[model samples]
Each structure stands twice: as C-alpha cells, then as structure tokens.
Target chain A: MAEWVEACAAEDIDEEDVVRFDHAGRTYAIYRSPDDEFFVTDGLCTHEKVHLADGLVMDDIIECPKHNGRFNYKTGEAKGAPVCVNLKTYPARVEDGRVMVELD
Target chain B: MNETLPGMVIIGAGECGARAAFALREEGYAGPVTLIGAERHLPYERPPLSKDALAAEAPGIRTIAEADRFEAADIRLMLSCEVAAIDRAARAVRLGDGTALPYSRLLLATGARPRRLPPAEGSKHCLYLRTHDDAGEIARRLRPDARILIIGGGFIGLELAAAARLRGSAVTVLETQSRLLARAVPANIAEIVQAEHERQGVRVLLNAGILELGERGGAAVFRIDQPGNDAGSGPTEIEADTVIVGIGAVPNVELAEAAGLAVDNGICVDACLRTADRAIFAAGDCCSFPLEIYGGRRVRLEAWRNAQEQGALAARNMLETDEAHASVPWFWSDQYGLTLQIAGLPDEGAAVVRRDLGEGAFILFHLAADGRLVAASGIGPGNAVARDIRLAEMLIARRAAPAADKLAAAETKLKSLLAA
Candidate 1:
C-alpha cells in the first residue's frame, strides 16, 4: 500500500535547503538540492539523534550538524567519516508545486 | 625474482592503515595489499571508545570496514602482528613472528599509544582507554553508583566522565592544569565545557596536583594538593572505586626512528607524506607533515577526520599521484548534549569575532589582522554553527579576507560568500 503525503509547498524550500516534514508523528527531512531536485530521507543522523533537517545541505550532500559527517542527498548514502550507516530514502516528487513523499 | 608481487604494505591497522588499504582499492590499485596491526581486534575507530562505546550504546563496536570486506577487496589483514623493524635496504618489514613482508611502497600508520602516568605502576584499579579491551573493561566498571575518578581533563577524560555520569556513576575529574582542555581549547571554551560537566553532577577539580595513588579497602585513593591556597601546603585525598587516566598519547615512531627515518616529535614526512626514503611514506597521527594552510607549520593531528583523509591521501600519493595533505584540520566533541565543532587552527594574535545565537548557541570566527578567516568554532544543540563554520574553512583555504562584520552578522549567508 502506498500512502503519498504532501510534505510542504515545493516553493517553501529554497535551493540547498532542508525542511523537516512531519506527518502522523513521523518526521522526514525533505531537501532541495542545488540542482533543484527534491529528495526525502530519514530525518535524524544514524550516528546521533540529531535531525538532518537541521544539517547543512551543499550541492548534493547533506552534512550532519552534529558531527559534520555527510550523506548523499539523492541516495541517502553516508559519504564521509564519523558516519557509517546509510540513511533511508523515501520516494519523493514535486507535484503541482507541492512536495509529496511516498511512505509505507 | 621474488615470486610474490611487490605490492603495498601498511603497518598498524588502525583507522589510518585500514582506510589507506581501502582507498588504494577504490583508487584502482589492485596490487597485493597487506595490512598489519598490533592489536588483536580488527581495525576499529578509536573516537567512539570514549563516547558511544563507553556509554554502552546501541552500536557496541565499530569497524571502518566489515571483516569480509577485506576478503572481497583482496586486502590481506594481519591481526595481532607487530612489526619489529623496517629493513629499508631490503625493502621489507620484519614482524615479531619473524615473517618478512616485502613491499614496493610502505606506509607507517603505526599511530599512537596512551601516555602512561608517572610511576604508572602499583595502582590496583587504574585504567587507560585506548583499545576495545580497554573500553570493555572501563564499561564494566562504570556500573551504577560506582565512583569513578578521572586523572586528566582532556577530551578523552571528559568524555568518559560524561558517560560515567550517564550510567549513574559518581564522576570526579582531577586536572593538574588550571582549566580543562588547557592545551587544546581557549580559556573561554574550557570554561563553558567545565560548566557543562559540573552541571551534570561531575565534580571537576582544577589546579589540583596529583601526588600519588594508593589503595584502601579495595578502592583507589588519589592524594592531591590545591594550589594558590593553604590547601597547597597540605595533601588532600579523593577516593574512587575505579580510576581512568586520560593523559594524552605518544606517537609510535620507534620503528620508524630505529629504521633511520627522519623523526622529530613524530615521523617527519614531506607534503606528499613521503618520508626521506622515497620508498617509505607515513600519515595520520604518527607523522608530522607541513600544514600549508597554517603557514607550513608542521602538525600531527589525532582527529578521526585527519586520520581518514590523510590515510587516503597517502595511498594516492603512494600510487605515484601527487596529493598534498592540505585540508584544514577539523574536530568535534559531543559532551553533555552539546556538540563543539572547530575548523582550522586559531593562530596567535588572530582577532576573534563571536555571534551569540541565543539559547546558548554561538559561532566564532578567528581572523587574521587582514581579516582572513583562520578558524571557526561553533557550539549549539540545534546545528547552530556547523553549516557556517565550514564556510570559515573554505575562506581560510582561499585566503579570503572577508570583513569581520560579514562573518559575525547572523543574517549573513556564508554559502553566498563562497560565490564571491
């Protein structure tokens, strides 16, 4: 079963910005890459409990604010040191100026 | 001709050695790689030894690569092996077990060991946090209501103190210096860190002299003297069931030095991490290389980032590609729910501009007289300065002298400055 939830207005997220999307008490970090692509990932860093939405998004990578460890925005793969586990990615798309993510 | 291929041999299978091997494979070097380490456990990260591992958190132990990954990568990992001597003439290293491994290029990643306290012997319950076994022993002693005494006020000691306090252990830190992290951080930063520990119910004693360690009723007792008061004239006592000594580390340069390689405070290597002998190279905490970003001052960093970056860089350099270890030094410490990330070396006489982001969050930029950002440190619970502090590293790299006002202004977007 696919449940698509409208996270936020796509226009609300600026280039290279990340926003926390909360629905039914579950949180996800939706990011707008520098390339203007939208992607959604598990909100918190696996290394620590810090939220990835509060991290720094540069180009296609999101640097965890807690440790400066980075993750690939599109695939949610841990790309740098201090972070070993991969971030779970969700199916995300922009429809009619709104960012929608598919969750199970 | 020797039947074995003349491949790369890396000594000391810590983060640096292990990562160098993996980087070599990733960089398309398919030669026979041999990774040797003194410790019996597979190469694991040392940073967590004082953090999550100490706390007995979800992630029990961490390895840079999985055990099977070595086999998949065709990298031979030799555990519990000690390299006794390096025969530069023969282009081989002799292990303690009397096996000589030949290599075309060698990397000395034999990191560092904990510096033992003076008169280190005779303490029944003293411990040093360095290896997996050490962490396990320390964790076992950190039972609830256990009294733990830490000997130094450095990063490792403080981290252990935080973990102990988390486990309901009574923590007490004794610092011979007047402040915490005296050598590493500035006075203001130390004050904040000390305050955080104190607030967490950890008794911190600064400017206290440790006279001796003795045991009474199955407990370790520390004799101390307090400076600047009558207490200095008399020896006082603090007792604990367990004592952890987090006094710094000493570089394992004996093998390199014995091999007649250039050795100073650490193994001396060039910008390419190549030692005096072109066949040999060194990186990570064990080697001192020129830090061009900081005016070519030779520095050996013990941070996890430095080890991984330098290790990979050294591998590339060994593959005959010239790569300089010029990345700005960066490190972070998580304590009492606070993450302090610092980038670059704050030079002496550098002007510091600070911005308070309310609710105990702030960012500081250290700039030269010409206003070139030299370093930046951010402390906050909510990712306050991590993003912006990286900008400072870039500015430092480019030698960009942005105005101090631009750096201090909360409204200023650091990324925008990158374009300019």
Candidate 2:
C-alpha cells in the first residue's frame, strides 16, 4: 500500500538545500530545488550510510559528507567512483504549505 | 587486441591500484587487467582501521570491492603475490614464484609502509598498524584492563587513542612536538582536538621524547625525557600493556629505484603520472607528481581521496588520454564526536580569516600573501563543517580572492562566494 506522509513545511528547506525527515522509523532527505520543486530520497548515503541531509547540495546532486560520494537526489543516480550503488528516491509533492512524500 | 598482449598490469592492489584496474575497464579498455596484491586479503580500505574497525565488537576488513565485482569486470585479482623485479626492457614483471608476466603498461602503486622505531623493533608488546592484520592485533590488545600508549600525536596516533578510549582502555599519547597535529593543522584547531581527547579520558603528553622502548615484565615500557624537568632528574619511565607506534610512513620506492626509475621522496612522475619511461606510471602514495593547481608544485598525497582520484587519473593516462593532476589536497580526521577537515596546504597562507558557526564550529580560511584563498581548516561536531570546507576547496582551486569580511561573516554563504 502507498501512503503519503507530511515531511515538513515547504519553507523549512531553503532553495538548493536539503533537510532530514523521519517517518515510521525511516529516514528521508527532503530537497527544495532552486526552482521551488520538492524532491526526496533515502536519508543515508549508499556509500557509507551517512546522513545525506548533512551533505552539500548543488543543482540536483548531493555530495556525501564523509567521502564525497555524489548522487542525483531527483533521479537517484550515483555520479561516480567510491559510489556505485544508486540511492532510492520517493515521490514528493508540495500540498498547500506542507511537503508530502509518498511512502511504499 | 593482440592475443599475446598481457594488457594492463597493476603492481599494488590497495585503494589506488584496485581503483585503477576497474577504471581501466570503465574507460572501455577491453584489454586484460591483472591486479596484484602482497596482502593475503582482497583490497580493503585503510582509513577505517583506526576508526570503526578498532571500535567494532568484532573487527573485520572493509574491502573496496568484492570478489564478484572483480570477476564481473574481468579483473584478474591476484592476492598474496609478490613481484620480485621489473624487467623494464622486456616489459614484464617477474613474481617471487619465478613466473614472468608481460604487460603493455605497468603501474607501480606499491604504496607506503609504517616507519619503524628501532627500539620497538623486536618488542613483543609493541605494534604498528598499516594493514588489516595489524589492526586486528591492535584491536585485540585494546582491552578494558589494558594500558595503551600511543607514540606520535599525528592523525593515526590520535585516532588510535580515541578508539582505545572507546574500548575502555586507558590511553596516553606521546609527542615530541609542543602541540598535537603540528605538521598539518593550525594550533587553534589542534588545541580543540587535544581538548576533546582529554575530555574523553585520553592523556595527551606533548614535548615528550622517547628515550627507549623495550619490554619489561611482559609489558611495553618507554623511557621519556621532558625539557622542563630538572637537569639531574634524568629520564622517567612509563609502562603500558601495549604500545602502538604511529610515527609516520615511508614510500616503498626501493623497488622503483632499483628498477632504474627516478626516485625522490617517492617514485618521480610527470603531471600525467607517467614515469620517465613511457611504458610505466605510478600513483597513490608511491608516486610524487606535479600538482597543476599549485603552479605545478610536485607533491605526494597519502589521503584516501587522492589515492582514488589519482588511480582513476592514472588509468585514463594509461589509456592514452592526457590529464594533469589538478585537484586540491583535502584531509579529514575524526576523534570522539568531533571531526577536523583541512583543504589545501595551510602553509601557503599568510593570513587567516575565521568564520564561526553555532555550537562551537568554526572555519579558518587561509589566504596567500596576494589575498587569494589557499586553504580552509575546520573542526566541529559531526558534519558541521563539511559543506563549507568543500566549497572552500573549490574556491582554493579557482584561486579566488574572497573578501575577508565576507569570509568571516556567518551570514555569507560559502556557496555564494563560489559564484563570485
């Protein structure tokens, strides 16, 4: 069953930035792109299980804080070396002022 | 491809060498790739040896790639193997087992070995860490009732101290210098690290010289001398259940030098990581290459990222693509709950601007005499300083002259400074 969960207020995350959201014992990273679009992915980096929200976000890529493993938050594609596994992404939408993500 | 061609042969199967092997395949080279390692286990990460590996309930190797990955990539993974000689003229490497393998191109990634302390050479209670086996031995000795004495206050030593403390062992660090991390980090940041270790119950002794190291009563003992002591007081002795030497590492350049390759601090290589011989190249801790970002200054980096990047770069050059080594130097150390990160060479800076983040996190932006950002060092809890330090690394690579006020101001985003 698919369910929608409220992550945070859309304004909580700055443009081109990401925030961590926990729901039902699961961690997710909520990103606010420069164009005001919302995106979400698993909070932990696939490389070392580090929090992706603590990493730097530029454009659509999130660089891991520990080892600089890069991933495209929107598409969940690993950029290159040190990270060969892709991150799992979730569909995110802004409903009113709240950011909601679909969880399966 | 010629059936007789042996393809790409990598000498060392550590991070750099293994990465190079895979990189060669990734670059669409269909040639045969053989990766050789002296260690019994597959290529594993060395960084965690002093950190998580030590703190783990059961220590184990963190391999860079699994056996299946190597098999899938068609990389011939040879472990517990040793190369006796490099037949440069014949373009073949002779193994210790007397088997000779020919290669189209050879990579020397022999890496480095821990510098030995003469006095502790044969002491049963003294140990040095550089491999998975070494980490296992050290981990076993870090028991709750053990007294751990770490020699040298460098990154390896301090990290070991933190790990020992976490294991409930009483830890003490000895350094000949006046402060910890004097070689790389600024004193201010180093002080914070020392403070954290002290808070974690690890005793840090600076300006302490080791007169001798020997085993006494089945324990390691060190005779130390301090400058401020009375003249006739002589040297004092300290005993510990185990002693770990983290002094430094020396590049394994003997093989390269004997093979008639140019050797300075390490195997000398051009910007593209190729040695004087066109058919041979070196990277990682084994080679000292010119840094294009620092006006072609020749330097050898031992950091993990450097090893990985240089490995891939060497692979590209091996495939006939010319690419100069242009990345800024970056290093990080974690102790207790704090992490210290440094980007670029701090010695190049003539001025420093401080930027404070809340909760005791701050960054020191080092500027050259001409006002260009040369380096950035930060110490904080968790990943508090990673984002800015990374942005500062980009700025350093660009040789940006960011304004001091803007750099010192917390409100000014370092990412915006990148745009400027």
Judging by DockQ against the true structure, name the best candidate: 2
Best by TM-score: 2
Tens-digit lDDT track of model 1 for B175-277: 8888899877767777888999999999988888888778889898888888844545534899899999999998999999999998888999999999999
Best by lDDT: 2
Residue B176 in candidate 2, Cα distance off native in Å: 0.8
lDDT of 2 by residue, B1-420 (tens): 453677899999999999999999889999889999999999999999999999965698888989999999999988999999999999999999999889999999999999998878888888999999999999998999999999999999999999999999999998889999999899999999998899999878778878887777888889898775466354477899999999989999987898999998899999999999999999999899888877888888889999999999999999999888889999999888898899998988999999999899999999999999999999999999999999999999999999999999999999899987
Please report how far candidate 2 places residue B100 from its true position, in Å.
Answer: 1.0
In terms of docking quality, model 1 is medium
Poorest 10 consecutive residues by lDDT, candidate 2 chain B: B227-236
Q: What DockQ values do the models have?
A: 0.57, 0.81
Chain B TM-score for candidate 2: 0.97
Question: TM-score for every candidate vs. truth?
Answer: 0.94, 0.97
For model 1, what is the C-alpha lDDT against the true structure? 0.85
